[model samples]
Target: MSLSKIKAPLALAALSLVMLTGCGKSSSQTSKKQEFSWSTSAEISTIDMSKASDTVSFDQLRNTMEGLYRTGKNGKLMPGLATSSTVSKDGKTYTFTLRKSRWSDGSKVTAKDFVYSWRRTVNPKTASEYAYLFEGIKNATAITAGKKPLSSLGVKAVGDYKLVVTLDRRIPYFKSLMAFALFFPQSEKAVKKYGSKYGTASKYMLYNGPFVQKGWTGSNLSWKMVKNKYYWDKKNVKIQQIDWSVQKTPSTAYNLYQSNKLDALSLDSSQTKQLSKKAGFQLINNGGTAYLQYNLQNDENLANVNIRRAISMAIDRSGLCSTLGGNNQPAKTFTSKGVMYVGNSEYTSGIAKSSEAYNKYRKSEAKKLFEKGLAELGKSSITVSIMADDTDSGKKTVEALQSELTQTLGKIKVETTTVPFKTRMARREEGKFDIMVSTWIADFNDAISFLDLLTSNNSRNYGKWSNSEYDKLIAASKTTSSSSDRVKDLQQAEAILLKDEGITPIYYISTAYLIRPEIKNVYNDNLGGWQFKYASVK
Candidate 1:
């Protein structure tokens, strides 16, 4: 699923933000450390893997749950609950050999756990937002659409420790997708015991990963990740506990970091400039894009191609990046760089070079288009409002866009409303805004993660933009067996989306942070979420 709806601030690290103090120490000394204090800008929404659609919740889930596979350093697939797997010659079937593991409650983790979780997620009654990710699995789409029984969904257990999964077609990133939180195993007994209360709080959920979450109420901003003694790989887990807190304001977070209360802090634009020379300052280029999603179904002006193009072209992306500071760069396409490649060359490079007219700042052309659009709509002026998060960076982003649109598109009035992250997401889901400021952090290392969001039938397609040709190309990309043909289809679809200004590309996000020197072995999954399983205090 897409990470979150708010700006990148809510898109903080995927795992716990590790922090520590002290000089280099021996492995033995590090192994004895008790706890590490960490901080994030957003609170956990829900830990239910099936229902989670945001980064913060998924990050926490990654800490406390284990799937068939775990994403290790550099996006490599590591053994989790499954120890090995064999694929059929036709590439439509997979059989996995499981490991002997136990959940925090001391119940054996078996293949039945995976079967139960997969069925629950795809069941129409469950209403999982991420059920669409299972589209390629056999009967998954039909099951999610309520056209098939849950038992027909192609996953089953063989005995106690073997799992068999059948797919309708080959998914190129199938193994990587298995590492995502949505694929984590869920205990039927726990779900039955808690029923509606399942995953609502730490006490109601079962954990099989390196840590067990505690102290998190449904709405609290503080929690703890205590090491799980029942984890199969417990011997390799070093840290005893992780203290997690939320600090939305950059200044407050930075203050805590300075006072040794926090081990890391995500910097704001101004703080990034002021702390570039600090010893532990680092810029994290998360494969994420922040853009503008127009409500095409609800707003008449935004539905017009000319008006959407006008709003897109009027803004100076480079200037906006400068105003916001940090290392953010103007986005040339919806997909960020370093995600996928079309034969050794980055996929987005060719598309960006070809989209100069649409991406470049052209105030005069934008003004002409805006006037023409207004004339065609039989209106002298139009009023529009942008919805964004109430955080400092979110406010700056909308304010800058408002200035550019009103200045370049004369007779157009642009208003801005900034709400808390959760409220803004609710409004966008309800289709209650003219323009919504949105951000997406890829769930995996693939361009499809971003491009799939604009498809006409996508649940995440908040704008409701429709293009038959674009949808066809996207569908073709998935079915074609040839790698080159798939690339061509995706490229053409992205080109169409850009030419029509379906969504205005803003900038690629690069967050800055300060980490103490004593933290070691921490690594980010290729998608940019950090993993603390192997982390140690040194």
Candidate 2:
């Protein structure tokens, strides 16, 4: 994501005046109700939450649906369709009391909607990349493996408004998981009506949340949202409608923002410093992390703990961030900072400390480690392959890394490769490369979401990295009843993961958006993408 772009507020002022002039003719329609819309960098990949994998698809579905719970901007749990929920003392069972809400089609959204959605997401036929998210549901694993019928899964509807969920073990983040798009309620009617095309576009879906997706033609360059009268909490919604556009290039996005086509847009580092001085310009520091990954499954050299450790130690994180030119924080941990808290304390960070800090990036340490790693692998020389995106930032980072490692490590050669985003993902899934630069954004503000990916059985564990002890620690943390105990167990798991060098923690990402001043009340939560539900133009 090359986010470098800047737009002057003077240009935005002109565009806003033009937009307001146009709104004068549409004032009658605007006066009848409230509404706001904004453009995004990417198009909605898909609307079916059940099968959607990437952030873009999930964001669209999030607005059009509801779940048992939802996370607020502060990252706290809040009631969504479910007014209240109860958990058994044993922590294995959960009961949800649903609030009366009607879908966009005027049909009641019930416990059955949730059950159907959950089952559909987990069914092998659906082939959802997120199928593994239901691993804790009773018999869900079996059902996903095709050993049992969907009904065998633990979710059951007591009635139209009550839902019962049984879990194989106690998962402290169960409610948080429900808040994700994958677990949002689904209408079987909508699915059956749309058949294969369900969620492919706006026409194929229904909205149950505070905003109804309007004017989204699946492939349109722009879209709009209207307030959903059907939302249970519609009364609290402030804005009425939002107009949005799609601008993939940050430079183009900046131009749109200047033209008042967008209220706010994410800016790159260059834009940040310049825009920070502008009035009404605010930078939101959200939680997301980016990192370089070495495929332990393919490279015998990187598979050696010393080589991996030496590689991790070789990079100057602060220098790298300076070269990249963003508000990106030098990552001191595998999990992103500000993502989760244990008691009043932030999660522990720093893999092995920066090599520059320890003065260990000298050629002596690199050569020693390289020789030691090569001796262990019974090879005279090692060739490591690096696959990365072709973005300007990516090319620069890879080039710098290629130069640094080759100069430092004697007889150790590093090769760089570039691939498009989708093709790179395919190669990753097939475990086709040696070293790859990859990143993980939080699904719902949980430390485990990233940590759990390294588990042996996780599909996202492309390197097939496994440590039984690490898995046991994570599992124990989930099942433990006490928060204190769970945190301790999780800390232990984190320690093990870091010590073993499964992944090289890179840097925490800072999302920057440049918005036109006319847009107001756009909701942004760290757990999900940007939201326009309560947005309106001035």
Candidate 3:
């Protein structure tokens, strides 16, 4: 999922702050009597799993939807709708035994829900951006490409409670992938009833998870997630209601936190530094990488490898991170650190030395390379604009990049444009910018979640960077049975991507937040996406 910029709404008003402050009862004992208030910078773009592409929407979906498995603390797979699953010996087939569950509307959730959901997402008419994620499932790629019928997409409802899935090849991370919101089951009855209006707002959707969303009007900046009575695990749910609001400015959100109006506040760079020692402060490692995506197809200057490399080397990533703090780390590769491992070490560690030259800041070398690239293109100089969100942090990021590029690369002009988060995302998808500042959080704890986006055929490869060898290595990594061989293939692929400067890795993001002391069980998945399913306010 992509990162987002904040939008402001009026402060949530007149809500009771139900707190239990007695000595006899433990925090857990009083949890059910409390409500939690949370803040987000962005609005929910869409609740429809097939169309939701931003982190905000995905996080909200996780709260109200149940997949086969739910991602637990540290990326552990916890059973949701599925009680158990068995894989075929060749690893090409999986059969799941679903537990008895009921949707918020009191409809039984069966294997047919899974079958319908999968088919709907992969159907060519659905135009789902996430359909590419179903690549390994048998005929999924072909179905999405309109080369095969939707019924041939390899998933079936064996019975009311049993579901089967066949894969075109072995997928090592298949189980983890199921934890994503895109794999969640949808109610066919609700979808058909609502049709085009489905998932546009909370009222149009059905929930089978721990919570049922309400008060969302699609474009509204506030909403509520109330405990779902029909949920199978409702007895274990503590928080009775979660009030969510959007606060565009960090200071505004911080004020709400200080006044007890909010249970949590996401901090920006300045706030992180100012409140580092605060009691409720936390630094969350968001297993994602922010980078500069060059428009190779439209921008002739950016099409030159030397120019791309020069732009990459011109920016001092360490300085940039210092400017925009929150414990951001300079990225040496596109994949974030700690997502994958090779032998006893992290995968990024293996390629550190090889990637140093390209990632390191060297103004003189960058200028030389920039000049040579201009000469090769038969131009004296060139101007390029960088686009980013219009929020405070987004402006800061693009300004820093502009300063670095113009100062380091002589005779080059750098421009900047800041738009709303949604607009920026749309422009990026259309390849409408010279360089777009993009952030990608891993869908799972695997390097492929980041690497596969830049593949030639990937729908997310907006920059249009293509390399045959890179594509081959990525394809091989997916099908290889040997764990060590897969690592080697991925490592070599990363090296090629860096050498060619397909994209300029900026920094690894670590978000800072101030969470109330009374809030408990709130945690993040392995990929750093927040999880509040089990959260409670004491």
Please give the ranking of all candidate structures by TM-score, highest first, separated by commas: 1, 3, 2
lDDT of each: 0.77, 0.65, 0.78
Give the Cα-based TM-score of candidate 2 against the true structure. Answer: 0.85
Per-residue lDDT tens digits for candidate 1, residues 73-167, read: 76678888888999998788999999999999999999999999999999988988678788889999999989999999989999989999999
* Candidate 2 weakest lDDT stretch, 10 residues: 5-14
Better of 2 and 3 by lDDT: 3
> What tens digits encode model 2's per-residue C-alpha lDDT throughout 1-538?
1111000000010001001111111222344445433554434556788766555555556666778776677567667888888899988999989988999878898899989998998889997767887988899989989999999999999989999999998887888788777788888998999999888778888889877877667677566667788888887777766665654345655665565444555555576677776755654434555556668877677788878776766776677766655466777566666667521253453223332222233457756776788889888988888876554445656787788778777576888986544455568668898887765556666777667777778766777678999899877876778887777777777777766677776666555455545556665565435555555556
TM-score on alpha carbons, each prediction:
0.93, 0.85, 0.93
TM-score of 3: 0.93
Give the lDDT of residue 306 in candidate 1: 87
lDDT of 1 at 217: 91
